[model samples]
Target: MSQEQHYTFGVSTRAAERLRSLAAVFAPSTEQLLGSLGKVEAGALDLGCGPGYTTELLQAQLSPAWTLGVDSSEHMLELARARCGPKLDFALHDVSRLPFPAPPAELVYARFLVTHLREPVQLLRAWSTLMQPAGRLVLEETAFMRSEHPAFQHYYAYLAQLQAHYGQNMLVGATLGTLCEAAGQHVLDAGVRVREIPAAQMAALHAANLPTWSQDPYARAAFDAAQLRQLGETLREIAAGAALAPAVSVGMGYVIATARPPALVQG
Candidate 1:
């Protein structure tokens, strides 16, 4: 699939602004995940790193000797470079592809990335080659989401459908451990972390993202323009604190695994 077709979300300025909010909302959980790594000698690779927020988190939490943020969009990479400066590196590469331009890393971190790719097990296997024999692989993905509000429910349903049309899974976190095992990694930890997100926070996120994908071929075909407009208005109202809604229950699946050592050889 072409790059445009691969990712439903556009890299427009609004999308970048959404990413900033995304980083703030998810930072604590991501920091907890990184803190579990303890120490890193070689450095960390932030796969699908948009705007370098996660890279900044890694540097702050782990103090890795070096850091590299990788993404497919040059526009995002440019933003990442500007945000991170010379202290960290940013590479433009489709993370789903193997043979990344950078060297092996001691830690590979991907947040909300696998859901956008096909054959996550294969992708995990390929990622192992980018890590040292004992390097750690960390991932955070959406397992499922729930909300009492009709607007949130409708938005998630349509978003899931749109992602499925592109051969991706919106709730891939449920199978993260199995994917790691199938990829030959030694699983360390795997479980879901549930967070109650305020309606305003989630509404802001959804509002920021709606414009990026509302015109997608799949979205347009599945949803009426009037329906999308109403959804957008509701989201904006909630985001602006003018409307009230129940908190959203988000189930985030996280996994920590290590590459199995190479087999021993005897002459």
Candidate 2:
């Protein structure tokens, strides 16, 4: 996918590395999601596997005979290759298209990938076909996120608008369970987890994301250059703990949904 198409975030070297760091926050939930998939065999697939951070976690948890991380960004694949072992290989392909040019995987995990699709349900059905019979599909996404910081809140409001323009959903995590059911997958488990990060970490997370979000031409068209620059400056201030912004921590809600392909009915 072109950078313009992925307006929410880009795949620059910096962005991919930052994404790796952000992935750490959800490591615990990711581990649980993998465990919920029960005994794993064959292989696993990490769709939209940025820098292979999640892939690394998968290797440690499931230790599948083969693991593949697929992403459209060659730059991200470079970093993923550096981090992953021979067992975990990466492929360069756009996820929006269907029919992955690889073997069917028994375990498929995708985090924060569906929100980008205009028709996530269609993508879900395609993903089901990629799964082996009774294979598991685990997904993590955000239901809602809010911050007390003025600059942060202001920036997010515009960011949401920009995502809408590109037909993306900033809060698609809320409906993941229903979407999974619609795809004919049996819901195994589903729940929400909330994270409250201190201003310092919040600053770090946004420091990486804000630049990617603001630098997009779509974002630029939505807000003036001065507005983005000010938000950037405020983010730095928050990271440095110099700003007198509200002491409230950044609150985020993540919904982790797990489902399995339905077994065929017997005669």
Q: Pick the candidate with the highest TM-score.
A: 1
Give model 1 RMSD, 1 decimal.
2.5
Query: TM-score of predicted model 2?
Result: 0.88
Off by over 4 Å in 2: 1-7, 244-267
Clashing pairs in 1: none
Candidate 2 Cα deviation (angstroms), residue 234: 0.9
Of the candidates shown, which would achieve the greatest lDDT relative to the real structure? 1
- TM-score of predicted structure 1: 0.94
lDDT of 2 by residue, 1-267 (tens): 123336377888778767866887667767776666666778889888888988888878888888899988888888889877576799997776766867888888888787776767767877877777767788887777667778768766876787788888887877887888887667766666666656655666676776776567777676787877787788888878887555433323333333353445221
lDDT of 1 by residue, 1-267 (tens): 123327777888788889999999999888887887788988799999989999999899988889999999999999998888899999999877767998889999999789988777878988988887778899999998899999999999988988888988999998899999999887889999899989999999988878877668778777788988899999999999999998999999999988783342111
- Looking at candidate 2, the ten consecutive residues that score lowest on lDDT are 248-257
State each model's CA lDDT, in order: 0.87, 0.73
| Per-candidate total of colliding backbone pairs | 0, 0
**lDDT value, candidate 1, whole model:** 0.87
* Colliding pairs, model 2: none
